[model samples]
Target chain A: MAEDLVLDTAIRDWVLVPLSVVMVLIGVLRYFVSKLLRSSQTPDAKVVREGQLILRARNLRAAGGFIPVKSFRARRFYYTNEENGLLHVPKGQAQNPQAQMFSDPNMAMDMMKKNLSMIIPQSLTFAWVNFFFSGFVAAKLPFPLTPRFRSMLQNGIDLSTVDVSYVSGRSWYFLNLFGLRGLFSLILGEENAMDDTQRMMQMGGGFGVDPTKNLGAEKDGIDIIQHEWTLPKMEQRAEMVLRKLVK
Target chain B: MVGATEEARLNQLESQVDNGGGGAWEYLCLVRKLKARRSEKVLRHGIFILNSHIARSKLGGEEWTLYEQVAVAAMDCHRNDIANDCIEALSKKFPGSIRVGRLKGMLLEAKGAWPDAEKIYAQLLVDNPLDQIILKRKVAIAKAQGNLAAAVEYLNNYLETFMADHDAWRELAELYISIQMYKQAAFCYEELILSQPTVPLYHLAYADVLYTMGGLENLQAAKKYYASTINLTGGKNTRALYGICLSSVAINQLTKGRNKDEKDSADLQPLAAEALLKDYKERAPEKLPLVTAMLRNIKLVS
Candidate 1:
């Protein structure tokens, strides 16, 4: 059998520890940078009113059991009536041509800014790590890995003799990138942007500023929800329980 | 070291405040700012800035929510004048807002005007009978007035509409216990346990109720529930520890001529219970006398 390669302590001090620490510091830096770059836009009064109306409709559907059947029916009619339902598009907007999301210059500008913020720091960090700390085995996993993971673990290294357990500098950096979430949440609060998991999810098209689409989707949801009034049987349930109490 | 870390957190928050990013002037942010400030004077200054922001229309869609939160915080810190000012501003801005009306009721309740609070809630309910907030306030008023039966009725009505409200269920169970209705309380805990079987509190509560309404069947069930509670909490609950001892003895006495399997199960419990009590007594020496007295009473009963 071939001899197992021993890793030097110097690698731990110079490569592994520094890579982990720098990755965490970069995350903390990115958190503040993103926070500083982002602008808070207050939605207009009409948009706020629309959002509130949707929420009220949803609350009525969920907890309408508390109200009498007459009140429930009145609310259901108020929100769903064809002539003047709250979800209906106003006549002016229906007549006038509405702007497509991609056609809006402001939306394009916002998307460009978001993409720049996300891409710039990430590419810069990747370049910095590759230029300075490439081609070295920095650390080893405690557990053995199959040959399928050899290429992933040994990103900058190209030694067939090297064990699959050994991690190259870039792989170490990537590990720290994903693994520092808990530590960041411990130092910063839960909502801090140092959580890379949320950033990854957002990057995968979860975050956007398309209010028109959101409103349309919400209207569709409201239109389809079956409004079975919960109040009609509630009094009976209460009486049954009260009778049991007397027993 | 602690001071340095705290300073770093404060600096980050202050930078966010300067940039006007996130909810810097909102209630939750204000809460963090209030907790970080060393002196009440600093908190008062922060509140002043928050009020200025509200005055300048800097806050957005949820401005009423922010005002309500600030009012609540003001009430907490005994700044009743500020709370009233915020409430007055809100009531002026949204004259017929049910949320604002509810806050007015809460403020009245805070000022020891229970009748006035009740009246406001009743009025709100007449207008919007489905409002859960007003209904809850009515229940709270009933509870604060020490009318257990009235509180129970309100809670039962509340539960009919909002059956999934765990807090209301727990409150109802506690009210039943206060009125010495152990069977009804047991029913409430059973519902809670059915919904959330893994919560240690529900198991412990069920075990306690079963222990109180003692019979051979109840004691055996109580022993099993106490065991579950102990397992869930990793053997830390002293009440569950005592419950195991008492129920085991009760089971043993009640099943004097029962099957060997039942006797064997009951026999194992007291030994484990004694070991748990010993560990608990060593861990909390001040509670040792009470633990010993409880075990002695169980032994005497058996």
Candidate 2:
């Protein structure tokens, strides 16, 4: 039954409104920046072929039951045959973790550019919020929260006596950081770079997953499939149905 | 032609926005929807919306997509200048964009600059070997140049890498059929049928190809596929029903005088004939007598 803090109208203008507006503007700016910085380099042929190979292999594994045994065997042999198979990654091929990033300077450079775009704007916004708004408590939330939220919703503040619902300036900035995703998506289209959540996922996706490993996995997948020529079964089924219709 | 009701709905949308009401965004959205549905003859409305300065400014982000769309429609309608303007704008905006480059290549193709278009596509392929658009354009270029064999080669090469692309398989199948390579066409259809066993379209096409092949084994396979098509479509596919009856009769003729094979399709003839007769009776009662007469001539119902 503790009393709620009556937030000043000035806090609304200087803190809350400005924080929201700046977040939006920053999102828009970041989108345009990333769009400009996006490398228009045509994808390499080997990488393209590898992706297509995976897709083809996946399709074979999923739908190979339908094709004739001869065709399926031929495909399996083409992909999984020990010596000259396409999916075969020679074990002698020593994989260096950084080798891909180093060999393809363009790819590494593109990622660097992406990271810079995301990181620079993000840090700048953090710093801007910290500098201007510092320890100023921005607003009070209407709803109650557990004491566990106190540290999260009250980032830059020292006194822990305040309710967990009271959002501090820095925490409000952090809140706006993640919370404005919907607003950003609304203002900018779904594919916009304004989505940090997607960027984080992409970052975690972590480049150069050693294409050899992917190929080997697909190779194993294709190796296990038992070919059941679907047309033969269909013929029998059709014959059975036709026979039954007469009966 | 599109249905009159669809045309009327479009007309209302077009006039309401184009004449007085200021719903440029809504009109643009409708146009985009039409584009998604692949509805042809949106050229006039699209060009009008694109040309209007009011709508132009209001269409944030979607403006470029609209430009690309209208440019394509303009190219299809043979309005080269409009396409040129749209391409110029896109190229200016996204200087080295592959999509814009494609538009440029397509523009060259539209203008009948065969070699130039081919050169652009070749360069695009070189730059991005994985670029399916460029590869597809290469096939298109070969087709446009009246080198169907080359087109087939290019498409085959494309499919060799991208084997899972059903659309590519379908296109290749059609190309094979067009060149009268029924065997190759049948192979493509077989692949299609195998990949998508549930699709009646693939079954029907495979049946057609097998029927065209016309051996005892092929005819039997064709009859089974036709039956599959009928079953998949819940017996509503008239072509499939007809195909079933036709293939069944052909199958019966082939197996005549031979001791009936244990798993023979002799009984399918009557079932398929009955279905076709029932379908014709329900769908087109006027044609039911003619169908009955035809069935009688074929000796299915006698």
Candidate 3:
């Protein structure tokens, strides 16, 4: 009788139905989020971007090995080291009294103008796309591809008992979809599973070189993959765990 | 053989130093009086005189006071080089207060030890990545060696870290031109023009590239750009070169044409040469020897 119940419900309903639902939801979410957070069109960016203009102008002056100071409309900021050179003029003034024989003033001017428009818009767009795609794509994967945050969902680890429910609900979702209850079951298999507490402590997400710091910052590094769900709270202990993890 | 008069003046200054109120200016005047004698001993003794003057300025001595004194001496006696050397020495002794690396770099470049000087510059970049002088030297070395690819790569790397460095792009364009990578050079000039729309020479460089590429085929566009360049530089020497480039473009068309009359061929070719000379005189006055010889060759052909 137990075999019949297992064969009829477990194979027919438990695995097939939920897995299809999860995959569909993942695809829908990816489509919508990608659309919402795309970069603005180029002309819209160019029209009211004075900050970018000033920044580009400064860059241009610096590139030509000339210190460019844009004193536009009475605000003066030296883009180059001004202390060493004494040539100063009123804001928006283009003359270089101290410029030597080999100095190319025209080239300097061209660089300043180019920086004003193209470079700023393109770079800002790139930054926006990078952040948007990384977060959205991570969210929509059908299987829980990211490393689970065990410490974050630990019982009595911090303030409320909310994490207990969250962790159990996530465990249930994985079991229903892929017949694997947690991260170790899905990736490594039960025999080679890391101790639960030890797995919780793994941190720092990725290992790319940071040229400035030379050493990467570890405490909040890549391993802490965040997950969020929104099912109702349950009163019973096991039900609470299920609700917490599923959401 | 010390002069009796100079000896008296030295004794008088030493007595003033003993009295505790003889300032740097007073000592400097005494040194000037000694230097007027024009003897090797007097000149050598002036260093002592100047050092004593510096000592007197310091009862409440501001460094600026000594600096001003040196400036005046440099201008008055044309001892500017000595003053600069002393300033550089003092700056090095106190490294954190000022950057004398650029001054030193320029002096090294002037001495034509560009490769060794570039090592100091490379070290400067490693120590202080944002240092402008270090970047300048890096660009200069790359340009001097005609390593446009390396220069472009270095500048691009600098730009990645220092995104606002517009000068990097300009130098990259110049490097492309230097290496005769004409298409890349034109793109660089275009990038420069985009940043500095008002500058005419950028357009001039761009047109020059098109002319040098296949000549006459792009003559109209070259003429338009050359005209624009002349308009921008207020008819500076660059204008004369623009005219010369135009003449060359026209002559190239005539020479390569299938049917060229004898008189028309001769006139067109020599006109191109004359125009080139006028262009050279305006754009590169110092290159007269090589340019004139080439002009003579063109004259013989015509």
Candidate 4:
């Protein structure tokens, strides 16, 4: 009876102890890794926002920013709102008035080219990793069910994870995220930081959802809730309507 | 925000860590949660591309450095295979990147050795069954091996997992037709037609299946669809099987003794002959060599 008790304890220990150790190790490692990877230079949320806008402007310039509109239909006015840094048009508009600031097709083409270069690979890598990692997690899960059941459960996650989660979970998201980021950086060119957190909020369907619900939509949270915080003016909306028709 | 599944998984993993006695199940579940988190991260990045500066950048430039990093990381971690799987998953978002890989895969698939490739693909499928490229590869390999049985099996499995994929159903139906599994083919076509009622090609395929199966009760439906198929194809251009439709219609008319009366009647106009010709062309394209072969068989019988 004593031996049996000892054996049961040993078996239970064998399963639990190593798992606990791995979990702690993983948690600590992830915490440190994120801290290390995140930018310390642009620490504040406001600073990050400013930096992002500036980078976007630079990208717009490099890509040749243009809003295809006739002068009579659309007028551009520059704004000096330091929060937004530099605006190409007056701030109080029904729509994004700055869109008209881009009248040069070459600039538009360049901007579009720049945007595509930035977006295509980044989006692809993100999607690829998303599916892959999700699949991996599902594939590697511990279940008391059949292999078919396990597979069905895993498929409920995504595709990319199947191979990725099998080998290592740490490197799973890391590699995919890095690859996507790098591809975007190379394609978009120079200094423009893509804010993944914001993108995620949008993707999660939380972007357009009523702001009062999500913490991110709070006044002090972030200015990404552009429609709610700073409503678009009338003239801008008219131009936007015309642009939609042409499209 | 994490979903209930991920939260539950995280809690389970956390409990394992806290209790310090959790087993392999805990580790595996934790790994799954972590992977899920990572996927959410990737999706987040994709959203960023859509709404931010990434969407406004040029093609094949430094702006896409993040994607390069992802590729490098995928390679570094030996997830090149996973990266390859990403080709189809990300196609809707990153057509440029995924299409390049897809075309490469297509080029490679053209060479024989698909059976060997099938083993590799099976491993990938075990990991991510929803992977379209890998699934497509497996289907092709199965077909090439003349293992129509296996192809049908995998196709059914794939369809079950991806219920909305009309392409898989279409392929399964086509494979059944090729193997002369008329009843199953007809059933598949019938199901596909129900799902996508407007696509005329589905209707034509269903009729072909019914006709091949010799389901006399199904003939009215078959004829209706066949006529619809002709209308959909503009009555002039037949798919690959124009001759078969023409011959069948002609045989039907002759069997009914209408052809004899029509030929004998002086009232029969040029328009009537044109209609007959149109039916022939619709049944089997004149360009196909099979039409001549079919004619030879008929002549011998006569």
Candidate 5:
């Protein structure tokens, strides 16, 4: 078996530390860039009203156990009633009239802007790292890895002799990209847009699930939920608990 | 006595805070100022903004909310003059707004004029029978007055209308506990746990309830729930760690002359509990005596 390779301290000082620092700096920069690119337009009045109504309905469902059966039933009737139900949008007021993806021009524009902001910075950072710090095997992971991670962890270097544990500079950048989420949150409060994982998910179209479709799905979910009054048996349950307590 | 121009400048700063552009130091200053009961600076700033917004003909319906917040802050600082001024501005802008009316009631409550506040809430409820905000304020007034039964009644009524309000349920549960209504409190916690099973607080609370109720069956259930709580929190909860030890000891005593399966399960818990308690004690040295006392109690019981 080949002996374990010892990396020089110069690689850590020059390549590994610089690559990691640049990756974190890029994340911070991307957060500010995205913040600048973010649309200042707030949701319109009708959209806000609809969202509040849906939230109200959801709240009623989750917490209905606290109220009386009569009140629960009344609220349930108000929400699920055929006419003037909170969930039932008036004709043409539905967010997606055609129920098609990319149907709304404004929504399409929003998706495009979000995708560009997320993709542009990430691709730029990757290209910069590949061009500047590609060749050297910079660091080794503390843990063992299978051969499956060989291509992923050792991106620029094509050495057959090198073990899978030793990661190239480019791979270190990617590792820092995923690992620096907590640091970003610590520096720029929890809700900052610097999270690489979240941006990646958005890039993969996971977050682009149309809000209109979500509303439709929510409506379906609300439609199926049987509004059984939780309070009717509350007295009995309370008594049972009391009896247990007294024992 | 602040002039309109000064107010306008202050209002610009207020807008910056509202827009999430204000620095952390600005928020820290506000908190410090409020804590010191020197909210005259903030109150003056709010009035300046309101005045500017009014002068520029930009006082939209949303501006009333800003006015209400300023009024509440002013009331907190005992600056009734600024509070009344903001309230007057809000009432003038949105005369028919129930939210504004509620704010006026809240201001009365803040000033210790409980009867007047109650009257205003009562009048508002008469006008709109199902005003959830007014109902909630009434409950708050009852709580503030130390009328636990009245608070419970108002909370129960409020829950009838807005059944899904977790805050209300928690408040009602706490009130029940205060009144020695452990069963009712347990029921409330049961509802909370059902609604949010993954929440460690709910699980811990449920386990606590079961522990307090303490029959053999209740003790066993408490141990299982305590186990779940410890599992959910990744064994970090100190109370849950103690709970496991206590419940295991209780279970062991209860099943002394019982079957092997019961004894085995009961036996497994205390060992794990001791190990966890030891780990916790090492991590938090100050809690060692408390953990040691609990260990003594467990030994005495078993």
Candidate 6:
């Protein structure tokens, strides 16, 4: 059985240990590289205003009950007004490429910078692992794997008869690259640039997100809130605690 | 160089950090709270904390915030060198950031480079037209240049768009008051009270403005606001109590020969006087006789 074949202790030092250490060091290197490449440019003003509007709308939704009924109604009307409200997007501007809302060219440039930071090191590492550490079983799992894991855990090896748990050299490096995230975070702290998954998620996150759509959503969110003014009740409670109303 | 209370607070802060009870971030937060208005103390302690290698290692993400805080404090204290170093480091971290650009402009403003700071702020405003901080900085610049008209104009422009900005409203009110424009000051205070009616400070300020403007109708309105302030603070605001007494006396004098029954603070005066006496008796027993004499002199206690 393949299980009977004893994994050499030399492999532990030469292959397994070296691969993990190299992966971690590469991660640390990637973090610093990305940190250096990170753009200092701020978001567009329309983006900032839209973000602030959302924040203000969220605050209004939260504290609408604190202000007077008339004040709340005025704010509600100002935001949700159909013809010319802040949240209202005319049909032309909604899809217009000429609009300021869609005119953030730096956003694309920033995304390119992020991708360069993430992709360059990733591809280089993959190439290095392929060239130097290929075709050999560098390590074996202590536990067994299901048949479905055969192609995944034993990449760069051709023989199908070999058991799935027996990991090849390049597969070992791939495993170290993806699986050493917890160890990297422990060393570098959480949310570090060493995180490929975070980068992957971020790469797909921010493109084509229309601020007007978000504002419309916020308007819809604010529409359903029944703002019962709570200040009078709070004042009543204060008076009750003092045992006298000053009037 | 520390005073006794300062030493005590610093020791408490050190103990809070050394005992593992509070981390570096917590110590920074305590430093901010302790010396918020004391620019010299903030600069001293911020530099001390920032220079400490042990604390620097533990700051994580909060180090940048502490740097920004200290930079602002250093600018306030006119320590341009410190602000420069802090802003430089922040720029290295977040290159071309508008936040850092604002800091650079503030540093220029502190160094008396008004034109340079104005240019930077103008560029910043061009980028973010609705920027509240940069607009406020322009107002500050105008004030610094002794251009009161320009400062008022800037504030008025800011208030046009941001009507709910209570700070701008309050600043405009104080500016108007400084210029002896009591009517405009009164309007600002009214906006403040209308938006945040529960705030006793605005009520008190509004009453003061009205009382300063001094007419029969204004006295009545001031008396009503003073009453509201007293109600808001539950008779503890001694100034409001005195305001009530003063406005009532003025009202009585003004309506001396008129139908005083329905037009003055006639019924409310005795209640206000009694509340004032009770407050003085409970809190300042030794001052009770003077308060009683004053109330009696006003003829409300008699």
Interface RMSD of each: 16.8, 3.5, 33.3, 23.3, 12.5, 6.4
Candidate 4 ranges beyond 4 A from true positions:
A1-247, B1-116, B238-273, B278-302
Q: Which stretches of candidate 2 lie over 4 Å from their true place?
A: A1-22, A94-97, A124-138, A147-151, A154-163, A168-170, A229-247, B1-40, B50-68, B79-108, B111-113, B123-130, B194-197, B214-217, B253-267, B285-290
3 or 5: which has the higher TM-score? 5
Worst 10 residues of 2 chain B by lDDT: B34-43
Candidate 3, B242-263: lDDT as tens digits:
3444545465555655534323
- lDDT, candidate 5, equals 0.68
- Give a tens-digit lDDT track for model 1, residues B1-302: 13566666666766665566544554245445445533243235446555575543765645666566667767667677878988998999999988888888888888879989988888987776767678888898889889889999999987755655667789999999999999889867765664565677887898898889998767766777776676666666767766777777777788775646454344345555565556756788888777667667767322
lDDT of 4 by residue, A126-223 (tens): 46544544422311323344435434344344443233222232233443343344444454443343434434454455223431222212212222
lDDT of 2 at A104: 78
Question: Which 10-residue window of candidate 1 chain B scores lowest in summed lDDT?
Answer: B37-46
3 or 6, greater by DockQ = 6
Cα lDDT for residue B194, candidate 2: 54
lDDT of each residue in A1-74, candidate 3, tens digit only: 11111123443254345544553343234234433543322222211232333455443333322111121211
Query: What is the C-alpha DockQ of each candidate?
Result: 0.02, 0.33, 0.02, 0.01, 0.02, 0.07
Lowest summed lDDT over 10 consecutive residues: which window, candidate 3 chain B? B37-46
Which regions of candidate 5 fall more than 4 Å away from where they truly are? A1-247, B1-62, B76-81, B257-261, B286-290, B300-302
Clashing pairs in 1: none
Residue pairs in clash, model 2: none
| Candidate 2 lDDT over residue span A68-103, tens digit each | 565678778988999989899889683654786789
What are the Cα lDDT values of the candidates? 0.68, 0.78, 0.44, 0.43, 0.68, 0.77
Quick one: best TM-score, which candidate?
Answer: 2
Across B1-302, the per-residue lDDT of candidate 6 in tens digits comes to 24578667766766765565555455567666655365675676678778987877677777888899889989998889999999999999999788999999999999999999999999988877887899999999999998888899999987756666778889999989988999889877766765576778988898899899999878876777777776677767878878878987897788884745434334456666776777777779999999899878878887
DockQ preference between candidates 1 and 4, better one:
1
- Summarize candidate 2's per-residue lDDT along B153-188 as a digit string, tens digits: 999999877776788899899999989999889778
Better of 2 and 4 by TM-score: 2
Give residue B101's error in model 2 in angstroms.
5.3
TM-score of 2: 0.80
Given candidate 5, what's the lDDT at residue A143?
88
Q: Candidate 6: deviation at residue B62, Å? A: 13
TM-score of chain A of 2: 0.84
**Deviation of model 4 at A11, angstroms:** 71
Candidate number achieving the greatest lDDT relative to the actual structure = 2
